[model samples]
Target: MSNRLKTGLILLTIAFLLGCILVQMFTQTLKSEITTLPDGYHNVLIRVPTTFEFCGEQVPLYDEEVKESFDKELYINVFRHSSTSLIIKRSEKFFPIIEQILREEEVPEDMKYIAVIESGLENVRSFAGADGYWQFMEETAKEFDLEISKEVDERFHIEKSTRAACKYLKRSYKKFGNWTLVAASYNRGMGGMNAALRNQNAISYYDVALNNETARYIYRALAFKEIMQHPEKYGFVIPKELRYPPVKYRKIPLDTTINDISALAVKYGMSYKTLKYHNPWLLMNKLTFDKKDLKNKKEYILLVPQNPPMPHSNVLAQESLQMQKMLDSILHEEDTVIDIQDVK
Candidate 1:
C-alpha cells in the first residue's frame, strides 16, 4: 500500500478507538449521576417501635444488633409501597378466615403475618418448589396430611392450607417452646435451626448467625406485622371500600368423577375461568377419582359461586342479558299457558 493511504487508515483506526473510549466514559459518568440521591434526601427515616412482640414474645430491641436488624427490615418493607398496599387490601378478605382457624387451632393470631411474608397473601410457588399461600414444600405438605395429587393440591386451598400451617406451627412450638424460634425454624428447617443452635451455642435466634435468607426471614415477617397493623403510620392508607371482599360461594359435595369440568361450569351458568378462581386447588380442566377413592366413598367439595363477580366486558354483559331474557321469556310463556283438563 502507498504510505499516504496506510497513514490515513492508521489515523482512522486510532480515532475510532478514541471515540469508543469517550462514549464509554460518558455512559459511566451518566450512570454514576443517575444513581446518586438528590440533595438533602440522603438517608431514609424508619421508626422502630420502642417495644415490639412476635406471638407475644418481646422483641429484644434493646440489643443494638437486633434493633439494627429490625430497623433494616422495617425500612425495606416501608418503602415497598405497591406490595405493602396490596397486601393490606387482601388482608381484609383472608384474615377473617385465617383468624377463625387460628383460634380453633389455638395458634397465635400474629402468626398470620408469616403467610403474608411467605406468599404476599397469594397462592404462589417459590423457585425452591415450595407452593401455596403457606409456602409448603411437597414433602412437608404431604407429611402434614395435605393432599398433593395431579388432580388436586390442597396446599392451594386456603382453609385447608391454613389449617395445615397451624398444625405445623403447633408442632414447631412443641419443639422449640418459643414462637420466635418456631418462626425462625420455619425458614431454616427445624433440623437446620437445631444445628445452628448447637454449633453457635446460642439460646436465642438473635444471637445465632444464620444464612442471609434465613436471617432476614423472621425480620421480614415482623416488619410486615408492624407495617400492616399500623399502615397509616407508614404512609399506606388504603380506603375501606377499596379493600377486597371475601368471596361468596356455595359448596357442592360429589364422589363421582367429573369428566368435563367445562360442561359442569356451563351447567352452573358460570365460565371455566370463574370456576377455577373459586377452586384453585383443582389443578386441571377435569378432576378424576381413583378406584380406591370411589371404594372409600371419598367426597370432594367444590365451591360454586353464589354471587359471581359482575361482568366487566361487553361480550360478557351481552351474554348475561341474553340469559336474563331467556329466563323471563320462559316465565312469561308459563303464565300464559292453560292445562288441557281446565280447557275441556
Candidate 2:
C-alpha cells in the first residue's frame, strides 16, 4: 500500500477505537451518577401509622390482619415505581373531573380513588368484560345508564363513566348507609357484600370475612390515596413539564349516526388516532343507528382534541432537525481530537 493510504487506515482504526472507549466511559459515568429510584427505595425496616381511614370510616389498622394487608399494599405500590408513577401522573389530570362529579352526587371525594384501583385511570377492558376507568361490567354499566354497544361504550369515556360510577355509588351508599361499605360493594357486588354481612352476622366490612380479591380492594384504594396525597413521601418525583397535563377538548354532539369515525375525524381536522385518543368510547370505525336509537333521538358525544398532537409532518421535521443537531455535536467532538493518545 502507498504511504498515504497506510496512514489514513491507521488513523481510521484508531479513531473508531477511541470513539468506542469514550462512549463506554460516558455510559458508565452516567450509570454511576445519582438517579431516581425507579424500582422503589426502602430501608430494611418500615413502619406504618396505626391510624388510617377510607372516606369517613376508619380502617382497623390496629388489628394484626388489617395491618398486614395494609402493609402489603403500601410497600408493593411504593416499590412498583414505574406503574405507581403513572398513577401519580394520571391522577393529576383525571382527579379533578372525578372530584367534581363526586361533589355533585354528594359522594365522598375519596371515592374517586376507586377509579385508580379499578383501571389505573385507563380505558382498559378486563378479562371478565369489565370496561373503562371504572371497570363496570356490561349489566352494571347499563344499569347505571351508561351506553354500551358495539359502536360505542361510554364506560371508556372518562367523564361519562365517572358519572355512572357516582350513580352506582350513591345507590350503594343508600343501601349500606356507610361510605366504607359502599366502596367495598363496588368491588364485591352490592348483593354479595350484603350476603357476606348477613352470613357473618356482621354489620361492617371489617367484621365480614371476604375473598382475597375483595378483601384487598379497599386496602389498595387506600394505598393509592396515600401515595397520591403524599407522593414525595412515597418517592415519586415528577417535574412540572414531565407530569401529564389534563386534556382539553371540544365535545361535538352526534344525533345522527356516523358512517365512519375516521371520516368524521378528517372533517374536524384531526387524524382518526387523535380522535380515538380524545374519545376512547368509540370502539369501532362506524357509528350506526337502528330505528330504536333514531326514534329515541339518542345523543352521543365525540371529543376532538383542542390541542391535537403536532401534525405528522411537523413531528417528522422536528425529529429530523434534532437528529441533525445531535450528529453535528458528535462530529464536532470527534473533529477536535482524532488522536487516540489525547483521549487518555
Candidate 3:
C-alpha cells in the first residue's frame, strides 16, 4: 500500500477509538450524577394533623379507625405526586367558579372541594357512565334539569353543571339536615344512604359501616381538602404562575339551531377546535332541535373567545414561521464541542 493510504487508515482507526472512549466516559458520568441526589431531597412520610373538618363538621380523628383511614388517604395522595400536582394546578382555574356557585346557592363554601375529588376539575366521563366535572348519570342529570340531547350535554357545561350540582346538594341538605351527610350522600346516593342509615341505625356518617368506596369516600375528600389547602406542607411547591389560569370568554346565547358549527367558528374568527374547547357541551358538528324542543324554545349558550381568535389560516402561518425560525437557528449554530476530560 502507498504511504499516504496507510497514514489515512491509521488516522481513521484512532479517531474511532477516541470517540468510543469519550462516549463511555460521558455515559458513566451521567449515571453517577443522576444517581446522587442533593441532601434532604427525598421522599418523606406525611404527618397527619391532629384536627380536621369538612364543611364545618369536625372529622372524628379521635376515633382510631377514622384516624387510620385519614392517614391512609393522606399517604396515598401525597405520594401520588403527578396526579396531586395537577389537581393543585387545576384548582386555581376552577375553584373560583365553583366557590361562587356554592355561595350563591347557600351551600357551605367547603363543598367546592367535592368537585376537586369528583373529577380533578376536569370535564371527564367516568367508566360507570357518569359524565362531566360533577360525574352525573343521565337520569340524575335530567332530574336536576340539565339538558341532555344528542348535540349537547349540559353536564359537560361547567357553569350549568355546577348550578345543577348545587340543586342536588340543596335537596340532599333538606333530606339529611347537615352538610356532612349531604356530601356523603353525593357518593352513596340519596336513597342508598337513607337505606344504610335506617339499616345501621346510625345518625352520623362516621357511625355507619358501609361499602368500601362509600367508606373511604369522605376520607378521600378530606385528604384532598387538607393537601390542597396546605400543599407546601405536603412538599408540593408549585409556583403561582405555574398554576392553570382561568379562561375568559363571552357567551353567545341562542335558541336557534346551527346547521354547521364549523362555519359558525369561522364567522367568529376561530377554529372549530377553539370553539369546542370553550364549549365542550357541543358534542357534534351540527346542532338541531326536535319539534318539542323548538316549541319549548329551549335556549343554549355558546362560549366564544373574549378576544376573538385570529383566523385559522393566520394562526397556521404564524406557527409555521416560528417553527422555521427554530430550525434555522439550530442549523446555523456553531458546532458544539465535548471535551473528553469534561465528561467526568
Off by over 4 Å in 3: 1-45, 290-295, 308-313, 317-344
Across 1-344, the per-residue lDDT of candidate 2 in tens digits comes to: 99999999999999999999999999888887755344646432335667877887888887898888888998998888899989888887898899998898888999988999999998888999998999999998899889877778899988889999998998988899998899999999999999999989999887789999999998898888788887777667777578788888787888887788887877777778888888888889998888998999988877777877755855787999999999889878956658878767
Candidate 1 structure, TM-score to reference: 0.78
TM-score of 2: 0.77
- Shift in Å, residue 187, candidate 3: 1.1
Q: Is candidate 1 or candidate 2 better by TM-score?
A: 1
For candidate 2, the per-residue lDDT at 201 reads 94
Best by TM-score: 3
Q: Which window of ten consecutive residues has the lowest lDDT sum in model 2?
A: 37-46
Query: Model 1 segments beyond 4 Å from truth?
Result: 1-45, 310-344
Report how far residue 8 has shifted in candidate 2, in Å.
59
> How do these models rank on lDDT, best leading?
3, 1, 2
lDDT per residue as tens, model 3, 27-49: 99999998887864545558778
Model 2 whole-model lDDT (C-alpha atoms): 0.85
TM-score of each candidate structure, all chains considered together: 0.78, 0.77, 0.79
- TM-score for candidate 3: 0.79
Q: Residues 103-206, candidate 1, lDDT per residue (tens digit)? A: 99999999999899899999999999999999999999999989998889999999999999998889988988999999889888899998999999988998
